[model samples]
Target chain A: MIKRTISSIALALGLAVATIPALASEGEGLAPAGTNIRDQASLQRGAKLFFNYCVGCHSLKYVRYSRLASDLGLSEEEVMTNLNFTGAKFGEPVISHMPADDAKTWFGKDPPDLSLEARAKGVDFIFNYLNSFYLDPTRPVGWNNTVFPNASMPNPLWELQGLQTAVHGEAAPGQEAVVEKLQISTPGRMSPEEFRGATRDLTAFLEYAAEPAALERQSIGVWVILFLAGLTFLLYLLKHEYWKDVHESH
Target chain B: MANVFSRIGDWVNERAPNLAPTYRKHMTEYFAPKNFNLWYYFGSLALLVLVNQIVTGIFLTMNYKTSALEAFNSVEYIMRDVEWGWLIRYMHSTGASLFFVVVFLHMFRGIMYGSFKRPRELVWILGMLIFLVLMAEAFMGYVLPWGNMSFWGAKVIISLFGTIPYIGGSLVEWIMGDFLPADATLNRFFALHVIALPLVLLLLVVLHLAALHEVGSNNPDGVDVKHGPKGNKWNPEKPIDAIPFHPYYTVKDLVGVGFFLTIAAFIIFFAPTFGGWFLEHDNFTPANNLVTPSHIKPSWYFTPFYAILRMIPSFFGTAIWGVIGMFGAILLLALLPWIDKGEVRSVRYRGLGFRIALGVLVFSFLALGLVGAGVTAEVIPEWFPGADVTTWENAFGRLMVLGYFGFFVFVWVYTRFGFEKTKPVPERVTMHD
Candidate 1:
């Protein structure tokens, strides 16, 4: 009976632990980003893409160029010559040259800094948002996203991924057409598979930008945990040795 | 080298004559119950985590910017620019979460073995005060980050004061020093979090340990070792079933600390955010007064009480009752010593009713935490298709709330009406490896 009671209590506690993470999820079916921050090659590719395409409007204000160079395994000269477009100092953060006031006038909102976007919204959300842009005649920017509908900014990577038009499902009377899927109307320089990979690389870079220490912490953690486990084993032996007195007396 | 150390020790002992004796009284000479089980590890572990929080918090504050405008960016600066700052910051965050983890388990042990009965009531009361102050400290420390969740969480919690009858609006404004949580609030919270509350927590912890040492520890079997058959090797007056706390428990607690730090290091290094439970994802964004998060809930530690506040419906044109229910939940736990008035201390000897009631309380507390976290809101629709989500949540949540409060009532009735059929307790503490 006592054993039964303990099992029941454990079951209840397990149920409680299992339920809390359910809040972290959303109903929207986001595609997997398949991005790895650990891949230096992927991160380098992402950095190149971000500098070329996204840096025109968005900023990575928290990510410093010097730190980026070190983390991405690039020399200062290579990063400065190839990736640094705005002539920012090596120690300076990646701030866009596009004036905030101008951005506000053009887009009706200032394009947000993308430094912490990957942290705020998961990498999957960024990947899907980048992929979901479609041509829309009614939108002011002539572009709309299915992931983040009515987004103000036009597709910045339109040259690479090409133009997409929404395949609308049947709508009821007086209702707007529901987007079933995005169909590529105009293919760009890259193939469909290549574009997806490019977007994943960009997402991976942003993820790294969000928390640069992720590259270091995991490596350091292994040694720390190993040391602690060893110490715990030794302490357990000492505790057992000391407890002999109590056991002997008993 | 030994002679020099002895001389220095003697010098200090001459100035402070009670030092060595006090150490002996608390450590080497102090006798603890021999049969302390796994539940006993949490007390020492809580102390270890407290030290971790204090040490890490000091390093964090050295670089942390307290003002609302600078705080969020400054945290990022620390994460990126400051050398090894991410480790310190993660340790503090992970320590804060783990503090509650160990403390909750410690409190559960107290309840399970009846550590708060009679002689140890003062110890329990002091512990409850520590819990209260620790909650305040944590809330203030959270707001110092100036993250979006921090801003909104501060607003929602402080607005609980707005449920006051007449002074509601003014009290909230007085607390924030503004209409909303802003620079003034952040500065004040930083002051309280760093300086004022930690001092109180430290004082209460010292007093709690002093009180426990005075009364001696309660064992798993709940036998009063002091009054049992006496006479040990150390002293004729000492309980036979007791051992010196230093060599025995000191070594034992070292093992516990090692295991604990292993888990803590795992969290601080690899999974510092604990998948948004420890350091929330919304908190990554800078605070914006213009927009509110879609979901605003307190940290996981506060969720059970937050659920209690939510589950208690507004009555008589006032939401004050809900606020009352929230505070009352904690107040009830603090008053456990009085509510559970029985000769039989441990659950091992306690009647079946007591056991079932305590189990229900544990289940309810954990379930209520899930409710407060807004998990049920997301889950109810998925589980029961076409169901009125709010209605389903409210019904289930309110029942859990009842179960939480009902434990105190049921225990009172069971003990008062002699419904308890306590087994005969052993004169000596039953020992096991």
Candidate 2:
């Protein structure tokens, strides 16, 4: 009886363990593997979007103007004249004009730095979030986010992306009321396709900025592994040559 | 035409087989138990989760700033401005907690099956090392946000190190590279958390797996199969005993991983701040050194040990005792194989004394954890202020602490001499064929 019970417990535990993978498969959100962040064109476009739109509230303090100019194939003068804000030098980082205290008072949360933003969040999330803005009157910013609810900051990209109101239907028996879809009441500066393209460029840029070395590293990694594999093959041949006579005798 | 293709395929096959004969030999000869149940999947799943964490973490570090003024905002910037930054951040944070959950279950499985016995001692030791590295990783990762909890949590944990006799304060400073856990510590920790420690963990994991593979896995029945027939080792061969890891185990793990993600996603996407615990309400606020959080607690994983530390009476000595006890529990696990001396492999054959002793240890741990979580204070009468200082909430705290350590001592003693010998299993009694 004891033996039966112990074995049964072990069996039960094993079965319980098997259930984990099934759970993982559900709600596997749409994040495809591999990101095309290394393309210079993508990076250039991303940088442009970042400078024009994101830099107003966000900062990239670790990234120097000099580095950006050289890496992106821009002249120092071009970077200084175009990207550099008031009172900034060629060597300085792109610091936000907004004070931290002022930002907190305005947004109820300080606007975060954009230096590592792409690296910290993936390109897909940024793309989705940028397009997820909806109108909410209760919020301090006169807007809420589907991606991040109760967000303190107003949809800064509202003019370009346009206005959207959430359409909610009645709740099911146990379920809460759901957002059926977002209805665009008014159009913004850019068309839907144009807005998407802009966000995609921004996402691509942040992705590049987050890991500027990723593209180079991945390409370099492939060659390194291949070289090592080739070396191993040569070594194997040498071993065979040395052991040829001994193996025949055996 | 068909004959020509077949001939070519056969020629390729014969030459290929001879060139890598050892590969084929291993494919056929390598024998894992056919009856390996769901419990066996965790180790591999853990590896998968670890890789996910490292990959996601590396990307996050690319954009993450270590400065006090910018750290919090940098994280927000990642969420708002950086493309797909939210996904990477969520995956990493969720993965960290999941890593612990899986490891805890894996360790519990080890305890259930007596996998930490004799010959497998090194594997257990390596596991303990991995656990230590994981704790360090989690602690460091928590500080990256530089929120109120991040600042105070670091302060509380680092101060514990200051309780050591002579040079403790200096040691803490040396670790931090400053007077307090400041920008220097955050920058260094970012490097270590993202790079150095993960490399160590990877090496240890390889060693741990290599050791387990060498000894083969232990089953619920703790018996050694070293002397059994070469083909009929461990247990009798059964159809369920052997299944391909790729599809069979992969599918199982996928299911488990899916379930875990659903729960984690719900928390991350919807109820990120469940009560005040998951993402502490105050942590939403930026770091402020002047103010102390009302009830500062480490993430849930460390709460049990943190509670144990609080139970101690002396300010300085309390911290010392806490560190010692935490390390001691882990160190003792490495020694379990040597301590247990039962003749039978299965718990079924083990004596009642051994079973009861094991039960007591489990109960005591749970009790200590409960007391650590503020239960003991509420239950114990307030009149005994002396008890609060002397014991954790007076007499109750003292008794529970004693019970915690006492259980370990008792298990070592009980396993050493308490079990009785038993006859070999009868042919009819053997379940495996």
Task: Name the candidate that leads on DockQ.
Answer: 1
Over the true interface residues, superposed, what is the Cα RMSD of model 1? 2.8
Which one wins on lDDT?
Answer: 1
For the predicted complex of model 1, DockQ is 0.62
For model 1, residues A1-250, the per-residue Cα lDDT tens digits are 3455357546754774575367445425888898999999999999999999999999999988999999999999999998999999999989999998999889999999999998888888999999999999899989999999999989988999999999999998999889999989999988999999999999999999999999999998999999999999999999999888888877
Q: What fraction of the genuine interface contacts, i.e. the true contacts, does candidate 1 reproduce?
A: 0.75
Residue-pair clashes per candidate: 0, 42
Candidate 1 residue spans exceeding 4 A from truth: A1-17
TM-score of predicted model 2? 0.58
Displacement of the residue B243 alpha carbon in candidate 1, Å: 0.7
Tens-digit lDDT track for model 2 on B1-433? 9999989878987878674444432333334443344455577778878988989888888888888878987886675446667667866876776687678768866766677776677898899899989999999998889988788899988888887889888989998898877889889888888889999999999899778767766655554444343333222551223322333344455555554455555544533333333445446556788877655778756665776676656654245776777667666766677666554555545666656666666555656654554545544544455455435454665566666667567667766666444446322212231
User: Can you list each candidate's DockQ?
Assistant: 0.62, 0.02
Q: What tens-digit string does per-residue lDDT give for candidate 1 at B1-433?
A: 9999999999999999999999999998899988887778999998998898889889898999888889999999889899999998999999999999889989988998899899999999999999999999999988988999999999999999999989999999999999999999999999999889989999999999999999999999999998988877666788998889998999998998998899889889977887678888889889998889888999989999999999999989999998999999989989998899888999888889898998899989988988998888887887889999889999999999999999999998888888888899888888655
Candidate 1, pairs of clashing residues:
none
